[model samples]
Target: MSTENGTIGSQGEVNGDVMLTHFRKKDDDDANGEVETEETQVYIENYKDKLLIYGINDSPPIHVTIICALQQGLLSLSGQLIVSLLVAEAVCASKNDAFKARLLSSTLFMSGITTFCMNIFGIRLPLFQGAASEYVIPLLLMADTDQTFCTSEPSKEGGQSPVPATTTMSPNFTNSSLGNYTNNDEITMDRIIYNVQMIQGSLVLAGFVHALLGFTGLIGVMLRFVGPLTIVPTLTLIFIFIVGPVIKFVEVNWGIAFSTIAVAVILFLYLAKYNMPVPVWTPSLGFRIIRYPLHQVFAILISIVLNWLLCGVLTYAGLLTDDKKNIGYNARTDARIQIVRDNPWLTFPYPGQFGPFGFSGAAFISCMIATLISVLDSIGDYYACARVCRVPAPPKHAVNRGIMIEGLCSMLSGAVGCGHATSTYGGNIGAIGVTKVASRHVFIATGVIYILFGIFGKFSALFISIPYPVLGGAIVVMFGIFFGVVISNLEVTNMSSPRNIAIFGLSIFIGLAVPTWAKKHKSPVQTGHAMFDKIMSMLVGNPNLVGTIIACFLDNTVPGTAEERGIAAWQVSEEDERADVDRTEFNEGYEVYDPLIPRSIMYSKLMKYIPFLPYKRGNVEKELGNVKTS
Candidate 1:
């Protein structure tokens, strides 16, 4: 592997056994499109740190963007646009036409950038771009289908439309924003065409960076500073940031929220009691007694179904509001999609679309921070792939090459009005681990799908229409799951220290609660913390203004003295340590850290807290050892 140190090995691995272990599927004769199994993901690292990365192993990292996507959709707007563009470029830049690594790498990179941007800039760019994992196989199917169908289809003028159909090249599709399953709408074809140009623009940047890195050979230098432990925490923090906003949402929309949660619970149980369909055929569970795919798709899907029925019931009971304005903005948006299908392309950004573009300065200024986050994302994604492949693709230079590809792609995506930089995501890694299919060729197929989706924007519209509450429910589960995962990952060198435990709890509490209070009061900053303008006579100190300024520079920007950040990071670390210990104790074991499984160790916490949950009347001093005895 190429690194700051040097080339350590070929960085290429080809073991029939490891492949068989992680990548195989029973139904697929052609294993290239097969799904990755949890077993394979479980085997990624073979050392102590492995335990740390998996965070109790059995669950998903729900915190990061999944929580953010549903609540604010901040990242969904720009972040999604950025990653999609970069991914398309990365896939296009792959040599030997091997695009899978480029796409998968983007997933982790997206997560990484999300972490880095928040820490480095006084910016928290929304990081909700999930990996385009689910779409890969479908694109592959389309690519490999008969030329008569996949390449060119019959026209819509009755039978074949009588218009001669011609085959066209598919746009590279791994562009993520192109294929999302939005909130509450059906997929349409118009979106597919518009995306092709956007996807093209995003990749244009990737090609430049790839060209620069490939020819200059600077890929080796970037790998030295990054590692798993640091990255894991940042990603973990993402969930923290996301969950805070989501919890507030549940509190605000209790009626819809409760119904949504109930639907997810029922679906999880149903899937557990019976066999269900999964790509390449699969069935498994570790916690929530719920199958993963079912939770991912049907948790929200079934919730919507039940909610619609409930909508009717509420109407019958005279408790439902008849005001269309209060129902939600989704219905009109959905109808708009159908109306705009034929003329959707007319909305694309134009150079002079608004005035002469002379002083469009604020537009770029406000978005400048967002653009940089995309770079961090690109860098993170490259490292994730470099680490996993374990061997340097070019004898220790692949990371640089890979990043360059994404960087240039970012510029292109930005020019096209996407503004968000392209990066990788972790969600896609789950897909890779489950499917075991690592072929770049299939990724290219996926890229083509994105292009089509971009062209047919209605597809995105359908997902966008899904109600916020249904999304809120999914975010709740994911946030809880991510909390479990992060807590599982929260290990420290000195866990016994009291100071550490206090710090851990306080940091988590503050981070979550501060955001909570702000969201509720709609007052992100207090008047005392606001900036004051000192006129010629006197000064006006607005706490909210000062707080806003401080909030902007506080955690991210290099504000104040070194003493400030060190103290803060350490104090937070202490709190994190306790949370980690508690998380570990709760999960029970290495088997996916399934807390759902009955285990004795988990009871120790409640018993420790209340000193009463356990049936056995064990002495408190003995149960908690140092806590009570000391």
Candidate 2:
């Protein structure tokens, strides 16, 4: 569908009808449902040709183009994973169907440019730009839980003896204090700083595998292997992974955090209550809700500044003495003075540091295990995107492109010395859903913001200034939206069980409230991850978790992906017998028209057929017929 334009139109569509089937729409803002005439359509198609004619471009956005960037700094492990997912989204989203020619070019140049600036200017790697590793869990479990850092020959119990006097390290590496770490126990900072450059090896390997899989179009098969249930847990993990940390943060700096949150709420209310001003921020870059007050963004801005100032003061006043002074903590960090002495400039994380540290029989095994989890996480992420995009599933190529980019970034991170594997986060997906602008270019714009930090270095304080509580507030609000979406995405086949629903919420409650309460009460474990791992270990240290068990039961094995498992479900369909309905959906070319299928899904599928350059409308009709005839 189109509207009147100068000579033609600008919107998403397939020019070559033979292979490409495009279903156009008038953007939601265009309330008028005027259809474009054939003549106008032809002109519009030619215009698209001209855009492609200019030669595709995807370099990092100019440094001065963007104004601000949101940095998820020092989150809980799960939160870190979610944050990494978000970071990956900002990066990978830049690579649309053009095979990321633009994204690759942009990323390569941006990375190099940033690396050079930090090297030359003696500049800090703007604390603003951080790549998170969702796979750090496995890597951390291996490296952090390893015997290398321990003192007394590593016993089974948690605490260990002081170093043997022969070695330089202590018994409990997690407890940096044991070895006289100067930065107290800033494990999050220490872990990422020391490990950033090393994770690149895992990233490169992951990228290679993902790219290979993409070329072979394995994403589809892999997707079928993962099911809604697996997604449920993974997403739940993601939610907890994301939101749990926020709650803990809220608990820690209650005055600063809660105050920041209160203002954010009031700001949201004001914005929501007022008549929004035009172009407060672009609809693409920010959500310009008609119902919300445009000025609340400023409230958020003010809150960020005030909280930072307060935190800076608090740290000075001994309120944050634990982390600032870093006395009897862990995470292998030394004092501020020592950090300055070891390396004046914080180094970017390298690629190979993440996968079991060194290449060994055991290291290899650990990396492989980590890789599997990465793949699993990636699969879930892809589906969440697919659901959001409204495609039944992603085209294999798209999946590969996305995954390869994710792995590639991880590989690069390994080289950079960070503990991150940036994957697409459902939380960001939630953001997109809330904003309702899924243009890949906008995320590309976001990555530009990430790259800009190294170029200009202005936004670090903006990020630094954001109070943990305010960040927590934004997270809780958005994730609440996402949790709703996931539940909506699922079938209620088992919803009747208060027990099952409780089981689902059990994870959420345990994951969120327990950690926050534990932290507020001053538990021995500093971060939520430590508490979670310890709790899970106590409850059941099963190599295969409850989620794994359910996925196996419903799907019967790691059939390798969500799609393969889908086919299995398809084969086992008792829908006809159960509901006594006709099933014409299997035969190829049968078209089923369901008005309920979101337009986004239809459009996404159509994009896949574009490269082939032509399509048979009858085939789509036939495809729809199968479902309709049913």
Measured by TM-score, the strongest candidate is 2
Ten residues in sequence with the least summed lDDT for candidate 2: 586-595
Query: Compared to the true structure, candidate 2 yields what TM-score?
Result: 0.51
lDDT of 1 by residue, 1-630 (tens): 234422222212322212112332233345684643222322212211111112212222243223312222221322243334343432222121112222322332332333333212211111123332212212222222212221122335434222111112123222232333221222122222222233334334433554364335443332233222223333443544445445544553467767877765665444433323323223542322211233432344456556645644554565644455664332222322442343233122321111111111222221332233233334444333322222121122223334443454444443332323445444332222212222222232333334433444444444434444544554564344334433432332133544334444444444345444533432333445322111100101111112222332333333333233222221212123223233323322112111232445543545333211112234545645744465
Candidate 2: tens digits of C-alpha lDDT, residues 185-276: 22222233223223334455654664455445465565545555555654565554544446664654556666665665565444433434
What TM-score fits each model?
0.39, 0.51
Among all windows of 10 consecutive residues in model 1, the one with the lowest summed lDDT is 532-541
- Model 2 Cα displacement at 575 (Å)? 22
- lDDT, candidates in the order shown: 0.33, 0.38
Off by over 4 Å in 2: 1-133, 150-203, 241-244, 262-274, 278-357, 361-363, 385-393, 454-462, 491-546, 557-630
Scored against the true structure, residue 577 in model 2 reaches a CA lDDT of 19
